[model samples]
Target: MTWSLIAKDVDGSIGVIVASKFFACGAVVPYVDAETAVATQAFCNPLWGTEGRLRLSVGEASTGVLTDFVRRDRGQAIRQAHMMDKYGEFAAHTGSECIDWAGHLLGVKHSVAGNMLAGPDVIEATSAAYLAGADLPFAARLIGAMQAGEAAGGDKRGRQAAGLVIHRGQPHAWLDLRVDDHADPLNELSRLWDVAQERFVHFANAMPDRARFSGTPTRHQIDEEIAMAEARRKAEGRGSRSHAVEFG
Candidate 1:
């Protein structure tokens, strides 16, 4: 009923892009954090995300977390999950009892997984797109991958929700967009992502981060950052087909 792409961004961030036939896949599938990112689906277990993140935060290995989570679960054979550490090490699992066309792929530092998908092509296309978009922003790269997956044929059951959650070198999300119960969730997600570029990303960039605990920037300073961000967007032709457009 779902598929996802979990990867480490070029900027050392972790991101998750997920879509499903289920409503509010965002509320269940992807568990994103700066230090580690995980997605648990199939006969879904919501605890995997929260508990896995805590384990990763405490210095556990991604492979260990993924294996341990699945191993300890009584319903392991129906579960599907994958994870990546901030350092780019990663792992994936596809339960034996998952529905037909269910499987997963692991790239250099990323993994693509799906269950109840249209076919193997869905996961393949998704992995290919993400691997090919090495120059795009973390969020854009993910969106493109999901778009490719959708083009190949997404959830066999049909699509209703899609979500993108990214943690760009922060414990909190840099961008978290969801299209719940939409006729075309991934496309709707794309539109919301573009809207986020208008101001949200810059504001998120200006806020106090883990590295800087105090002395938050002034509103005027934030405005300056937003201006600079806009200028960078213009320079790189962001939202268009361009390359290495780094801001925020």
Candidate 2:
């Protein structure tokens, strides 16, 4: 059994996450580029990933490309996946051959996951949440999708674990974060998402203009300050410590 999904934000960032009964679910299913993201699930044929991404790279509409690919695929054994480009275009597919309770959905900025959830309502709920459109980042959107799915009776098999990933301009890795191996995967994913926002701030602040301590100090002056501090610390019999600085 396999499950996978991917999404991109409005800011040209990419994220991909997936969970499968298969070990290392994250490794074989998700793919991302600077401009696009992809996921493949069910029998988890990784081929759809590169092929669909190639379509996106060539300027094909995500929905159309995905639809055609799924249609032509001879083996649709419960596959589910999502794709998005830097332009905010997106698409998703959930095969009819998926597990009895499996389904998928598409919405404004994201796509719903597919698998053995409570019922078809799982897809509806996730789709509704996406259409609701929260101001949160891509990670939150993913968690929201999971939450909706759970509320709608997610994983008739019962939840075992979850994960999340997001790509933001700076500090927010183009695709970073994970919360695998949990009893409450969606909630764990949310917790990781919040922590990721803090990372985003740290990354934002680490930019060239803000890397140094606040306030203007010429390069020479800053070097002098550093040297003076070292001298003073040494004179005060402080322990030997090296100092290093980066501009950006």
All candidates' lDDT scores? Answer: 0.85, 0.61
| Candidate 1 lDDT tens digits, 1-248 | 79999988766878898999999998899988877888999988888888988888778888888888877998989999988765677888888999979999989978999999999999999999999999998888999999999999899988899999888777778788888899999888888877677677778777678788652567887777768767887898875332236899
Q: lDDT tens digits, residues 1-248, model 2? A: 43444555666556665543344556666766656667777666687888877777667788787788788778864577778755667777777787766666655566556676567787676667655655766667766865776777766776655554554533224445554456766666666555434334344334343234543434555455556655765697864322335586
Candidate that would win on TM-score: 1
- The Cα RMSD in angstroms, rounded to one decimal, for candidate 2 relative to the true structure is 9.7
- Spell out the clash pairs found in candidate 1: none
Model 2 — which ten-residue stretch has the worst lDDT?
Answer: 201-210
C-alpha lDDT of candidate 1 relative to the true structure: 0.85
User: Which run of 10 residues does model 1 get worst, by summed lDDT?
Assistant: 237-246
